[model samples]
Each structure stands twice: as C-alpha cells, then as structure tokens.
Target: MCKHILNAQVSIRAPCCKQWYDCAECHGESQTHPLAKTAEMAFICKKCKKAFRKNMSEYEESDEYCPHCDNHYVIEAKTPQAIVGVEGEDARVDNRMLKDDRVKQSTNRSLFTINSDDLTDKVG
Candidate 1:
C-alpha cells in the first residue's frame, strides 16, 4: 500500500477580464486589473468576500463603500480620508505604531484606488 498525501491546491482568481495579456491588465481600457504604485489603498468588502484593488471610479467619492462592490469610483467631489481619531483628542499614538510593519491589511483585501491626476500607472 502506498501512503498518499493529498497536497492542497490553491486556486487563484485572475481579475475579471477577457484578455490575458500581461500589459493588458494595466490598460484602463485594455481590460486588465491595474495595480497601485504608491500610497497603498486597502479595504475589506462584505459583499465581495475578498479585498481587491479598484480605481477611485469604483467609490464615486464615497470613502465608505468598496469599489468592486460599488462601481463608479469617481464623483464630483473628493472623498476625505476616513479619520480614525476623534475630535478634540489630538489623536496620538505610541512610537510602536510607526515601527510595526506587522500591522498590515489582509492579503485578500483589494489595493486599487483611483486618482484624478493619475489616469494610468505613473511608475510604468
């Protein structure tokens, strides 16, 4: 009798698109998932079940909603970053917060965020 170990296989889902070209992902109109070059954006979506990078066009100026769950990230007004601190608290944290790289968003979270000035990947 041969001892068998069932190796678990993980399935990676490609961003929804028709084309499989490498560069095509960066193309806004090219039908590929674009990546964030600077200033990371991450969020967990209850609907999507996984975090995915999406442009600001997905939020539509609303900072609370997930781009993948809620399309139309761009809006007439700019969305203010969600303030974690409270008013009149001068929100201060210990030095440990800065040094802690371990504090990271989930790997399943999406990172894409749209910028008006950045139509395409600038790093490219």
Candidate 2:
C-alpha cells in the first residue's frame, strides 16, 4: 500500500514515533518530525505478517530475513517512475494491446504464382 516503494517487503517501525512505514520517504510525508535513528530496529514482514527486531550493532547477512517465516525482507526498493506507455495490458501476455486498426495483407498469396487459365486464354 506504500506509494514510495512499490516492492517493499516489510514495514519498518519508525524509532521516532513507533509507527510502521514502508520507507523513510513515506514516514517523512505523514509525520511532521524527522525520523529517529537507533541501533535496534523493528520490522514487520509483509509475507508472514510477523514482527522481528534486529540490533544494528550485531547485524549480519542472516538477519536480512524474517526469523518466523524466513522471508527475505532486504531487497532493492522498486520506486515509481515517470514515463509514458500505452494504456493497456502487457503486450506479451495480451495481444490486444498491440492490435491496431490498419489494413492487413492477405496471407494466402505469393508474388511468383501465375494463373495457367490466363496464359491459355491469351494464347487462344
């Protein structure tokens, strides 16, 4: 439900107000005060809906996952971007997105094909 980080896997509990947010930019938009920094951080995994805490001082590579569900919560955030695109489903999955109202060539013809009747009539 976060607008800033579209692919956020976990909600971080802000040390400042103890409120959960998907990203620091989201916290900044709703809260008036700046985020507080702390060595201990709390997070709620979106997949398993479980809460866990990690001490930044003792943080390790293994701490990047939720202890209860083993869901990898640490990942590169996918933020929204400003771009122009056709307003339709993915063209790869749905061909309708790529459909255009234009004249199409016949599939049952070849340039080298010649009518034998036309040649015989001309000879006669």
Return the top candidate by TM-score.
Answer: 2
**Candidate 1 per-residue lDDT over residues 18-73, each given as its tens digit:** 32221222335444356324333333343465464535445434654454666332
lDDT of 2 by residue, 3-121 (tens): 98899999999998989998999999999999999999999999999888999999999998899999988889888899996688777888965658899975654445566744532
Error of 1 at 112 (Å): 97
Pairs of residues at least 3 apart in sequence or in different chains that clash in candidate 2: none
Candidate 1 segments exceeding 4 Å error:
1-38, 54-64, 71-124
TM-score of 1: 0.18
RMSD of each: 30.9, 8.0
Cα deviation of 31, candidate 1, in Å: 39
All candidates' TM-scores? 0.18, 0.69
Worst window of 10 by summed lDDT in candidate 2 = 115-124
Error of 1 at 93 (Å): 50
